[model samples]
Target chain A: MATTALSSPAASGAAAAPEGAMVGGDRKWALRWAYFFLCLFAAFALMPPLYMLITGLKKSSEISAATNPWWVYHPTLGNFVELLTSRAFQIFFLNSSIVAVLVVAITMAISIPAAFALSRMKFWGSGILATGVFLTYLIPETLLFIPLFKMFATFRDWTGIELINRWYVLLLLYPTLTVPFATWIMIGYFASIPRELDEAALIDGASWTQTLTKIFVPVALPGIIAATIFAFTVAWAQFLYPLAFTTSEDQLVLSVGIATTLIRADVFNWGQIMAGALLGAAPPLIIYAFLMDYYIAGLTAGATKG
Target chain B: MANIAVRDRAAFATTSRPRGSAREFFRQKSTVAFFFTLPLILLIAILVIYPAFYSVYLAMLSKRMDRFVGWSNFTFLFTRETFWMVVKQSCIFAITAVIFKAIIGFIVAHLVHAIPNEGQRKWRGMLLVPWVIPPALSTLAWLWLFDPSYSAFNYVIVALGGDPIPWTGHALWARFSVILVNIWIGAPFFMIMYLAALKSVPAELYEVAAIDGATWLQKLWYITLPMMRNIIAITTLFSLIVTFANFDIVRILTAGGPIDQTHVFATWAFKLGIEGGDIPLGASISLFMVPILTVAAIFILRDINKRGERI
Candidate 1:
C-alpha cells in the first residue's frame, strides 16, 4: 500500500487504472491532511499582520469599546489619513526612505565587485577572505552597537563631528549588515555561471572590468535582483541599529519612529499605532509580494546554495 | 562545458606566454582583485572588526570609562542577581524558541511539500508573511493582541470559559509571550528553508524505501532527516545566535520588564549600557554573548564547510 502510494504516477498525468485508483485514494488522504495543517500554520503566521490591518482600520472609540476585539465594528480611514498626513510620520517615512535607498546603493556598489572578485578571480587569500566575509555577516548588530556608540562619541570628541543622533550614520553602519550577505549571494550565483562565458570574454581581449560589466552582470541579473531585494529589506527592517544610534525624533527611521514616537507615555493609541506599524511594514511587504520568487530564491540560496 | 573552458584557457595561456609577461598578467589580475575587494575590507575593518575589539577594551573599563579596571566589571556582573537572571533567561529564551521554531518549521515544511505543486506557491507565500514584516512593527501588533484590557487572546479564552491569562504582565507569561512571538516570526524562515531542502531530495530515495517495505515513519527517519541534517544544523545554529541576541521582541514587548525576568543579553545590555548611561557595564554585559555566538559560528562554519566538500 505504501509502495503504490509513494510510487504513484497519478500526479505525473497518468490515468488512474484499477491499482492506481487505490494509490490515488491514499494520496488524497495525505493531501487533505497536508491542507489541514497548512491552514493551521498559515493562520498562526498571518494573525499579527491581519490584526494590524484590522486595528489600523478601527477608530479609537471602537477600539476602546467593550466589543468583539477581533472584529472592527466601524472601520475608519481616519487612522490611515491621520498618519499619512502627519508631519512627524511623513518625516519618519522620508528618513527611512533615504536610509534604505542609500544603503542599498552602497551595499551593491561594495558587494558586486567584491563578489565577482571572490568568486571568479583567484587571488592571494581570496578563499580565507570569502570565509571571513561570511563570519562577519554572522556577527549580530546588538553586539557591536555599544562600542559603535562609544566610537561615534569619541569621534565627536576628537574631530568635532557628531556621528550619533544623525540619520546618515546608518548609511555607514547598515552596509556592515548588508554587504557580506549580498556579496555571498552574488558569489553563489556567479560561481554557478559557466566559466566559459567569462573565459571567452577574456580571450576576446576584454578587460576584467569589461567582462564583469558586460558578460557577468547581464547573466547574473537574477542574483543581482535577489541581492538588491535582500539589501533593501535588511536596510528597511533594521531596528536595533537605528534605535541605539539615533535618538532624536527627526533622525529616527520608520521602525524606530513608529515604536518610540507613536506611543506617548502611558497612553497606548492602538488605532494609530497599528496604522503606523502597518505603513512601516508596507514597503517590504509590497516588495515581497511582487518579487517573492526572487526573495525566496535569495533566502534559500544563502543557506543551501552557499 | 567546464572541461572545454579549461582546455581553452590552457591553450590561450600557452599561446600568449611571453615568459615574463605571464607573471606580469598574474600581478595585474591580483591588483584588480584587490581593488575590487577594497571597499568591503574597509567597511568590515572600520565598522565590524574595530568595534569588536573596542567592545573588549570598553568592557574592561570602569563605569565612567575613566579608569581601566581589569575583570572588575566581570566580577561585578558575576555578583549581581539580575546579571545571573539575564544569563539564565537568555539561554532559555534562545534554546526554547529555537527548538519550537525548528519543530514547527519542519512540520510545516513537510505539510507544504505534501501538497500539490500547483497550489504550493500560494501557500508558501502566505505562510512567509510573518517573516516578511519588520519584527519591530509586528511586535507592536502582538503588543496590542496581548493588551491587558483589549487582549484578543484573553477574550478568546474567556469565551471558551477559561480564565484570561496575563500574557505579559507576569514574568513567566511574558517570557512565554516573547518566545511565542519569536517562534511565530522565525518559524516561517525555517519552513521556507526546509521546504527548499525537501524539494531537492530526490524522489527515487522515497520510492526505493517504499519498495523495501518501509513504513512512512521509517522512510522519514532514514531519508528526510539525514538529507536535511546539514541545513537543520546550520539553520538551528544561525537561529540560536539571532534569537539569543534578539532585541526587538523583548524590548518592544516587555522591555525586559516584569522586574527584569525577561531580559536577554541584548536588551539587558541596552538597558544597562545605553539607557542607564553605564556604557562600560553595558559593554561587559553585551560581551557575554560572544562565547555562545562564537560556538554557534564555529559549528555553522564546520557544517557549511562540510556541505561545500560534499558538493
Candidate 2:
C-alpha cells in the first residue's frame, strides 16, 4: 500500500513522456501554473505549525514587546526550560500520562473480549449489543457529563465517596469516550481474520480463552496497536471531561490546567501559554510523526470495516 | 472424501444433539461467548445505559428537585429568550464549520495529490500536524493569539496600519474566532480522508479521461467528485454531528461568554447544568438536540452501509 504511492505515472512519465504528452503545450503550461498555486495553498495550510514553532521558540520579552511578532529576534529556550522545570506543568503532565495509559488499558480489557464475542459468537442479543455499542459513540461527552456529574454528586452525598476533583475520576470517564470506538474497531479487526483459524483451534482441544490469548492476540497485533493508539489519543486529548470533573490544582490535566490557571482576567501570558501549549501538544505530535500509519489505520478502521 | 464426509456427519450429529451431552450443554461455545462478553455488558450498562436513562428521568423535574413537572422543563427551555439564540448559533457553527472544512480539506488534499508521489508522504505528514495535536491545547494557542492584551494577530493588523480587530471581544468577532479555530482543528481530518480517497482513484481512469481530451477541471468535476460521492456524504455528515456537538473548542476558547453572544447548545447546557445547578433543564435542553443529530447519524449510517455493500 505504501510502495505504490510514489511510483505513479506522474513521477515515472514526467521524465519519459515530455515529447509524447506535448499535444497541447498550453494545457501543459496551465498544469504547471496549477501546481504552483496549489503549492501556495499547501504552504498556507502549513503556516500554523510553523507559527507555533516560531512563537514557542521566541523569548518572553520578544513576544511581549510591540515588535515583529512573526519573526523571532532572540530565540531562547527559557520558556521551554520554565515549562519543563515547573512543578505545575509536571503534575499536569503526570496526570495526563497516567489517565491516558490507564484508560487505554481498561478500554482494551473490555473491548477486545466484547469485540470477539460480537464478531465470532452468535448469541441471542449480540446484534443488538453491537448496535448499542455503536450508538454510544454518538452520545457526545457534553450531554453525558451533566448526568454523570449529578450521579457523582449523588454518590458523594449518599455513600461519602467523592469522585469529583480526583485524577482517577478521569480514568473512569475517559473509557466512556473511547471504549465504544475501540470495540467497534476491534470488532472490524477480529471479523477480518479468517474464521478457519478459529475453527481449527476449536477442533484441537483449545478452549476459547486459550484460542483467543494464544492464536488471535498474536496475529491481531496491528489492529490492537491501531486501537490502542486511538484509545490513547482520545484519552490524552479529552478536554470537557477533565474540566467538568476536576477543578483542583493537583488533579488537573494539561487541558484544564492551562485554561484555568494560565489566563487571568486581564492578563494573557502569551509566551508562557504558547510554551505550555507547545509542550502539551508535543507528545501526540511526536506520536503521529512516528506512528502515523497506525493512527490513520485506526481512524479509517470504520471505513475499512463498516 | 467419503471418509471425511462420514467423520463430518458423525461430528455434526454429536454437535447437534440437544440437552444430552454434558460437555455440549454446559460448555458450549455460546456459554463461552457469554463469559467473554459479560464484562463489556456490565460496563456499558453501569456507565452508559444507566446514566442515559437516569438523565431522561432527571429531566422531568424543576430546579428545586421537587415533584415531577411533566414537560415543563422542555417548555421552559423553548420559552426562554436565550434558547433560540443558542439554537441559531449551534446551527451556524455546525453548518459553517463543516462546509469550510470540506472545501479547504478538498482543496488541500487535491494539492497534496498533485505533488510528485515521492514527496507526497512528507507533505502529508506536515499537513497532518494540526490533527495530531489536541484541540484543547491548539485552541488555547488560538485564544492566546487573540488575547486582548498581547494578541499576535492584533499586532500584525496594527503593523499593517489596520485597526486592531477585537477577535473575541465583540459578538461577531468571537463567533468568527471560534469558527476559525474549529476549522483549523477539523480541516486536517477531512484532508487526510480526501487524500486517501484521491489516492484510491485508479490512475487508469485519469489516463483514460486525459486521452479523451478532458481538461483538468473537467476531469476533477467528472471523475474525482463522482467517485468520492459516498465518502463525501459520510464524511460531511460525520463532521456535522461532531461540530454540532463540539464542546472543547468553544469552551476553551471563549466559554460562550462576553455577553453570551457565541454560546452554542453544548456550552449553554454546561452553563445551565453546572452554574445554575439546574440539572433537569440542562438535560432537557440537550435532549432537544437529539432529533437533528439522530437524523444526521442515520444518513451517515446509511451511507456507510451503502459503501459497505460494495465490498
Candidate 3:
C-alpha cells in the first residue's frame, strides 16, 4: 500500500501501455477527468474559507455597499485590528486557549495511561473496555448536552456551587467530547507496537510504569502527537458543549463567542464577524497546516485501524 | 530507585507468594491495569453514561420537572405538527446529507487516487480545507454567503441574469442551504477517509483485474468497493450519527429557521430544551436520536468486530 501510494500514476499509466494502447488511452482520459473533478471539488471545498477571507478584509461600509461581495474594493485590516484590540474578543481567545490547553492536558493524562493499560497490560475486561471507549466516543455531545445542562443546574441547587454558565465548566465537559477518541487513537498506536519491546524492558527489571514511560511513550510519540492534536482540535472547536454550558460574554469560548456575541439583535457586523470567525478558526487551521500528515493519520486511523 | 525496588518486589511476589494473596493481587497486571483505567472509567460514567441515562429520565419527566409524566412529552411531540416536521426534516437532512457526502467523497477519493502521486498531496490538502476549519466558524462564513440580502452567490447569479436565490428566506431553500453547508464541511472528511481506504487497496489486484480485461467500472465495482466496504460502511454509519445529531451547521446556518423547516434532532432539541426552557421536551426530542443511533452503532460494532476477526 505504501509503495502504491508513493508510485506516480504516470508510471502506472506507462506500465499499462504494454498491455494495450486502449488501456493506456483510457488511463489518460481517466487522469484528465480526475483533474477536472478534483479542481471542481477543490473550488467547492475552498469557497467558504476564501469567502471568509475576502469578507474579513472589507470595511463594514463596503460590506453594506452595493458592490461585488466576492471582491473587496478597499481591503483593510481594520476588522482584524478591531477584533484583536477588543476586550470581548480577547476574552474569547483567552478562554478558548485555556480550555483547549487544559482539556488536552487532562485528556492526555487520562487517555494515554488508559490506552497503555488497555493495549499492553492484557488485563481482565481490557478488550471490552477498549471497545467501550470507542462506543463512548460515538455518543454525540448533542445527546448529552441537555441532560448535562440539567445535571449542572441540579448540582448548583444541591451544593450551591454553580457549574453552568462558567468557563471552567467547559474543562469538564469538553473531555466527554475528546478523551474517548484520544484513548482510542492511543490504543491503536500502542497495540501496533510489538510486545517484544515491552517484554524486553520488563525482563531488564523495568517496572510497567518505567517501561511504559521509557519504551512505549517514545516509540509511540507520533501517535501521542496525533492524539494530542485531536484532543486540542476537538476541545478548541467544540461548539455545543461551550454553547450550552457557558452563555455569558466573559464565559464563552471562541466558537460560541464568535457565533453568538459578535452579532447583536437586528444588527450585523459582517466584517468583524468574519474576522472573528477566521481568527477563531486559526489555531486549529494552523496546527493542521503544520502537522497535516499526523492530523489525517489520526482521523483515518480511528475508523480504518479500529 | 523506587521503580527498580517495586519491580523487584513484584518479581519476588510473583515467584513466591500465593496467587490470590493481597500483596500478589495488588501486584497483578489486572490490578495495575484497573488503576490505569480508573480515571477513564470514572469520566465516562460521570459525564457520558450518567448523562445518557439522565437524558432518558429527563425525557420521562413533566415539563417543569416537578412530577413524573411518563411518555407524555413524547406523546405531546407526537401531536404537534412542528414535531413531525422536525422528525421528517432531521431524517431528510441526515440521510440526504450522508448519501451526498459518501458519494462525493468516493468520487473525489477516486479522483485523487487517479492523479499523479506528487500532485495528490497538494490536491488532497486543498480539498480538505473545509473539514479543517471549525464548523461553527466556517458555517458563519456560509451564513454570510447565504445572507438574505448580500449573498455573494446571488451576486454571481444576478450578474448572469438569473434570479437571485432566496438562499435562506424560503423554507426549501433554507433546508437546501443548511444541507449544502453540511455537505461542504462533511464531504471532505469522507474524501480523506476514502482516500486512505483507497490507498490501502493493493495495486496488484487492479493490475490483475486490468490483465483480465476488466473495465474501470468493473474494477471499481469488484475490487475498490469490496476492498473498501468496511471503511465505507463505518464512515457512513459514523457520519449518519453525526449528521443526525448535528447542531453546528444547521444551528449556525439556519437556526431551524424559515418556520422551523430545517431543524434536525440536535438543533430542535436545543431550541426546545435550552432556549425554550422545556428541558423535558428537549430531552424527549433528543431521545428520538437513540433508536437510529443504536441501530447504526450496532452495525458499526459488527463491522469492526468482523474486521478484528479477520485481522
Candidate 4:
C-alpha cells in the first residue's frame, strides 16, 4: 500500500532495554508465549518466499501434482540456468535494472535539493509544497495508469512519437513514483541536522548550494542511501504501470514481463515462473539483506518524523 | 561624522531591506530554494497534475480518443452489471484486508514487544520479510502454493487425511486467496509501525498498570489503544487508500477473474482501459477511486500537521 511510504523510519532506540533488567515469576511464561507466537508468525512470514527458493531449484518434472510441493528432492539449477540464459528473461531483467537505476538517480537528484529547500531553506509556500509532495506520493499507479494510458495514446496521436511499448518511456514516469518519497525521506533526514550546521556555513560566506553539497549531502549520506533503496525497490517492484504502458515482449520490465510472457495459455511453467520470480526479486532482496536498517529507517522516517 | 554615521545606518537598512520590508514575499535564499525544487515541481505537474485532469477529461470522451461524450462513459458503466460488482468487491476487499492487517499487526507487535529486547530485532526482521519482498514476485510464489493440482497446502491437507480445497478455482476461494495474500504482504508493515508505537508508549505506564494488577486486555484497551489511536487512524486510513488501489496481488493472483468476482477498481480499470482497449471506460473506472483517496489524504495531512504543531 502507498501508505507503506507514509511511515517514517522508527528509531532503533525504541527497543533499548532497561539497564540490568530481570525477568521473574509468571512473566517468564508470558515470554515463552511471546516466543511461540513470534515463531508462528515468522513461519507464516517466511514460508512463501522460502517456498519460492525450493520451487525455483526444482525441475519441471519434479514439480508435478503427485510430488510433494513442499520438499525439493533431487533439486536442479535447471530452472535458474534456463531463465538466466534466456534472452527474453535477460531483457526483462535489463529493462528493470535500467529503469530502477535511472529512477533512483533522478529521484536522489531531485529529492536532495528539494528536501534541502523544504527542510533547510525556508521559502513561501514551502509548508504547503511539502505536504503536496507527500500527497503526491500517495497517488498510486492504479489511479494513474488508466489516465496515463490515455495520456500516452493522446501523446502518440499528437506528437507522432510512441510513448507506450518502449523501455525508455518508463524513465519519464518513474521519477514521479520515486521523487516524492525520496524527498520526504530526505526532508526527515535533513531536518534532523542542527540548523546551526547550515547557518554556520552561511556566516562563513558559503552559498546555499555550497552548504547543501558541501555539508548536507555528505552528512545525510545514510538518508540518501535509504531514499535510493526505496526508489529502486519501488521502480523494480512496480507492475501495473509497466503492464499498462509496455505490452511488447522486448519492452516489458521484469514484473509485468514475467506475468505475461511466462504464464501463457494455462500451460503454467511452474519452475520457470518461480525461477524468474526469484531472479527478478534478487536485486531488491539482496539490497534489503545488506542495507535493511536503512530501508526500514526510510520507510518509517516519514510516519514517525515527517 | 554624524551625517556619515546616519548614512551608514541607512545603507545597512537597504542591505537588510528584503528581510525588514513587508514585501519580502520569497524570503531569504528563496531563489536558490526555487531552483532546487523546480525539477520536482515540474515532475509533479507533468506526471501527476496533467495526467489527473487529462484522465478525467479522457473519461468523458469516447474510446477512440475523440469526441466529448460528457458523462456518457460513467453512465454506461453504471448500467453495466460488472461495474457495480467491481465497486462491491473493491469495498469488501479493502475493508476486510485493512481490518485484518491492523488486528494482526497489533497482536504481532504486542507479542514482539513482550519478549526481551535482545531477541526482538531478529524476530522483527524475520517478520518483516513479507513487507520487504516485492508483492508481485511474492504473489507468484503464492500462486504456486495455491496451484490446485500441485498445491503444497493440498499436499499438507492430504497428508493430514483431508481433501484438497480449490484455492483459486472457485470465486469465493479466489477472493479469500487474494485477501490472504494482501494481509500476508501488508500486515507486517502494521507490525513494524505498531511495534515502533508500542516502543514509544512509555514503559512506566505499563509498570504502573501492572502494579495495580491490570489485566493484559485491560491494559491494551485502556492504555495501548488510546495511546496508539492516532497512529491506528492514520495507518488504517492510509492502508485503506493503498489497498483500494492495489493491483499487483490481485492482478497476479486472480486478474479480476472467476466471473469478475475479485475485480477491484485497479485491476478492473486495467482490464478495461488497456487490455480491453476501452481507455475511456478504464479512465472512468479508475477515476472512481479519487474521492476516497482525497478524503484519506486530507485526514493524513491534517493529522500530520497537528503533529507538526507538537514539534
Q: What DockQ does each candidate score versus the true complex, computed on alpha carbons? A: 0.61, 0.49, 0.65, 0.45
Clashing pairs in 1: none
lDDT (0-100) at residue B119 of candidate 3? 93
lDDT of 1 at A289: 99
Q: Estimate, for each residue in A20-116, the C-alpha lDDT of model 3 and write its tens digit.
A: 7686777789889888888888889888888989999999899888698888888999999999999999999999999999999999999989999
Question: Clashes in each model (backbone N, CA, C under 3 Å)?
Answer: 0, 0, 0, 8
Scoring model 3 with DockQ, what do you get? 0.65
Regarding lDDT, does 1 or 2 come out ahead? 1
TM-scores of the models, in the order given: 0.93, 0.91, 0.94, 0.91
Q: Higher-DockQ candidate among 1 and 3?
A: 3
Please state the error at residue B40 of candidate 1 in Å: 0.5
Model number 1 iRMSD: 2.5
lDDT, candidate 1, at B299? 98
The Cα local distance difference test for each model comes to 0.92, 0.83, 0.90, 0.86
Q: How do the residues A86-178 of candidate 1 rate in per-residue lDDT, one tens digit apiece?
A: 999999999999999999999989998999999999988999999999999899999999999999999999999998999999998999999
Residue-level lDDT of model 1, residues B51-84, one tens digit each, is: 9999999999998899999999999999999999
Superposed on all Cα atoms, the candidates' RMSDs to the truth, in angstroms, are 4.4, 4.1, 4.1, 7.7
Per residue, candidate 3 scores C-alpha lDDT tens digits across B137-217 of: 999999999888999999999999999999988999998888888899999999999999899899999999988999889
| Better by TM-score, candidate 4 or 3 | 3
Model 3, position B145, has a per-residue lDDT of: 94
lDDT of 1: 0.92
What is the CAPRI rating of model 3's predicted complex?
A: medium
Candidate 4 Cα misplacement greater than 4 A, ranges: A1-23, B1-28
